[model samples]
Target chain A: MKFMNNVYQVITVAKKEYIDALKNRVFIIFVSFLLILTFVSIIVSSFDFQAKVISYQTALAELQASHQIIQNLTAPEFYPLQLLRGTIEYIEIIGAILAIVLGYLSIAKEKGNNTLQLLFTRPISKIKLFFGKFLGNVLLLTSVSGFMFFGIYLIISLIGKTVITNIEIEKIFLSFIFSIIYLSTFFSISALLALIFKSLSNSLILSFVIWIVFVLVIPQIGDTLDPDNQVPGGLFNKIGITQKSDQLTILKDFSSYEKARDSLEQSSFTKHYERLIFALLGIKDMYNGKTINFIINDKNSDILWLVSAMILSSTLTSIIFTKKKLINK
Target chain B: MNKIFYIAKEEIKILFREKIFFTLLGVFVVMSLISSFLGFMATNTTTSIYNSSVKFLIQKGINNIPPNPMLSFGALTDFRNIIIYMFLIGALLAVVIGHRSFIRERKSGVLPILFSRPISSNTLFFGKALGIGITIFSIILSAFLIGILSSLLLPYRHLLFDDILRLIIFYIFSFFYLLFFGFVGLLFAIKTKSESLALFIPICIWVGISFVLPEIISGQNPTALLNPIAMGQVQVQNSVFFSLMQTYLQPFSIGGQYTSFALQLINNTSQTSLINVILNNLSNITTLFISIIGTSTLCIYSINKNNIGKDEIYE
Candidate 1:
């Protein structure tokens, strides 16, 4: 009976939160940006494909005109699914920012308006309130992701004139699910910070600083440590360390550096999220055309990291929200 | 002039007091130091690699050794990472400075008080601009000082007067590039009703200018999007569509031009006189100059047009 009552309270609060978010102009703008960028990515990627094909054809024509024996002149394969590459990058940057803004606004608005005190006067426990907000946000994020995936599906099939496999659809769906978890980590952190900081603006500023560290600094640090990230191709490739065995042999010489780089990468949830999504979406050529099972199996650790981050951040948020005197600055 | 200086001084004081600004300043300094150290390490590693290779060739009785690429000024291109970091983080920092200049005043209910003062709108605008300009310059200068010190500590390469001059020029370009964004943020802050929206809109523009435009222009080559040195290495097959896009996008790509100009100075890969390199890239230089001037003019206009008492404050 108590559990049922708590659930009822949570649902009521969640519905209110959902309605408020829907009415928010900032939220609306972010969603619009995401959707618009999704379409733009598809269009831009298609043009990119066309350009590559044209360049290849031109090269082939030149070779034939000279009557030269042609080798390695195969036409580029058009992977309609590859159009999702830009979408992932957009999500990494814009989607993460949206999550941060939504999370910040959700708590900061309540705090700023002195509504938290009124809300506390209700029968709902603080945990229930926090859960309600989290659930509402999760639902909202889910809908956004659902719309994103469906739009990509429609654009790829209808506009791009390419058919996606059922399995490919499933993989895309799974990637979005992971994205939700990844994004929720940011949301939970922002919400937690909003609850902690006295000034709402300070909370928002700190959130952005944290965002820069995780989104830009940490990953780039890892990239810098790995000589491969210094150049266009992997540095190893540039230095004639091409073969897998040869690369490993050389890596052994710099195992300490590799270990340090790995640790730095491990600290960032973005790295985990990127690793999983990049594999699932075949952003890297090695993962291209691979089955979802194969990709997931290869990236099991990254998936685990992302899930752990989501769970850890949300749990921490709930605990902090319940234990802290949120109204007393 | 005295009133402007007073306002500017007060602005600087408030900026230093803000924890967010202080934190960003610290991060920028640390990043600069790290970038310079990394450049030093890269140079050292390359030198060692060349030495070992030469030793091995001598043992094999090979007489002629290829010149080490690391010995040239091109090796200083490792410091190009600093330019990339500045491009990525500079605009965001400027947004903060810009917000503090205009939006925060409105939020704190200080704008109305300022508006009632005897000072004209032009003076107020100039004062705020001057304050922001000095603050940004100081932050960059701090980073420059740290970078130079860190680089000097590493004895891998002898520091030349010419190299020091080039570094100073690069930072100057960086200052203008960052100032342009600061003015842009100020422009948006004055225009927008919502404080968060003011911040968000400028950042969105930053994203477009720094990331999206470059990505579109340099398709299939992500490195070129951030690193002008990498862009220099890219060989784009000519297409009318691409040409049109490049022409349209070039003016907006202040970050790219900054990167290119800085890399050209530090790397000197063209192996030409500095004046010739500057002359050859006159168009890029002019674009940066025009952008700074244009954005400053717009920012001033926005400040003048905005009525502190009339504007809605969305807190």
Candidate 2:
């Protein structure tokens, strides 16, 4: 009965978080803007402007999907899941900010209103209350992922005029689930900082600083470090290293340089999430047409790293929020 | 005027004491210091990879090896990544500085109290704006020096007079471009009822400016642009929609313009005089100037319109 009561408290708090985020007009507006932009970009990708601005990848997908022939472009089969590559990039950049804001507000508001102390005085223990808040965050994030899923589904069906295959749906579902994990890790980092710091503004600034480093800086460093990125089409392609075997053979001589580049990306969870999502979405050329199981098996370590980051950061957040001096102001 | 200067001086002092601001400033400096070295490394690694690829081809009995791509590269090529770093880090630091400037007074519940004094709202705005302008200038200048010093550290290269002039113009462009974001941060900070929203809205704009607009214009995946090679990929489609977008929205794509201009100035081989370069980019220069002026007007207007007596309804 006691365990059930604890679960009940967690659910109540979780529901409040979900509702609170919904009620916040700014959050709603931003979320809607993000969804609408993603959908519009996917839907109208064939028009010259959309093709030029929305992402050429989407334009390519459109050509491939509609079975239109453009010379110098050839694909044996079209992978519909690849359309969500732009969506994933949006989620990586804008979605991460949304998560950070959600995490900061999850506790910052309670402390700001001076209700945290009062809430702790109630029958529920600090640990349970903290868990409730975390649960609330989880619910809110799941709802966001749900909306993103619908937007992608709407595009594939409405635009492509083809129902998603079960396997395609499954791959997309897994991709979004990983997105939640990626976003939740950022949320935990924001919440942990908001909990630990006395100055909420300072905490928020630091969160953004961390966000820029991971989302923009590190991934970019990894890209610029790649020798293949040196030419217009690709440096390797320029030199007839079209085959993976040839590419790897050449890279073997510069193993340490390659390792350093990989290590830089590995240090940031965004890269792990991106690699996993890109593979699942078949956005990566090598991963296209590969089976879901094969892709997952190949990218399992990314899954592990992503999940571990979410768990570790969340644990740290919970521990920090329960400190003796939870809120000074 | 004396009082405004006093307010500006105090603003600078307080900004220096903020640990988060200092830490970010340090990051901007460090990134500026290493940007050229990283570019140099990118060239070295690519050349080395090319050499190995040639050797591998000879081993496979394939003899028609391509000439070295890096042969065409100038010392200016080593500074390519600075364009990206400016887009990624430089604009963001500006936003933070702007947000922190006003958010602090509002958060401390002191804005109303400041208004109660014998000071005009416009006076306060200018004071703060001047302080912010100087602060941003100082940061940009420091980054400029760091960039030059790092270039000096590049192995086996000499930066010519035009290279130095281009770097100067690039930093000048960066200062104004970043200042626009600074004003964006200030305007939202004053207008928004919630602290997080104040920050969130501006960052969303940053994302749009930095990544989204360029993606739309270039039709490249946002990530693909990070690869220096993709920077030069032309997205030329002569269609009504594409032409319309280029005509109207392209001017507002200041970040995209900045990136292209930065690459031209820093990375690409151009021997034009500084005057011609400036004249050629008159559209972008005017757009940036207009944007900064417009944003600062709105920022000051928001401050005057703000009811300083009431505490901010922060979430």
Q: Rate the local accuracy (lDDT) of all candidates.
A: 0.77, 0.81
TM-score of 2: 0.93
Question: Which regions of candidate 2 deviate over 4 angstroms?
Answer: A44-77, A327-329, B57-64, B116-118, B238-240, B270-274, B309-315
Candidate 2 interface RMSD after superposing interface residues: 3.5
Looking at model 2, residue B293 earns an lDDT score of 89
**What TM-score would every model get versus the actual structure?**
0.92, 0.93
Return the lDDT, model 2, position B170.
88
lDDT by residue for model 2 (B155-183), tens: 68668887788888888898888889888
**Residue range B24-60, candidate 1, lDDT tens digits:** 7777777888886766655554454445545655665
**Residue B173: error of model 1 in Å?**
0.8
For DockQ, the strongest prediction is 2
**Model 1 ranges off by over 4 Å:** A72-75, A229-242, B43-75, B220-224, B227-237, B310-312
Model 2, A55-147: lDDT tens per residue? 556567888899987666533344567666777887887788888888888868887889877776778777887888888887788888888
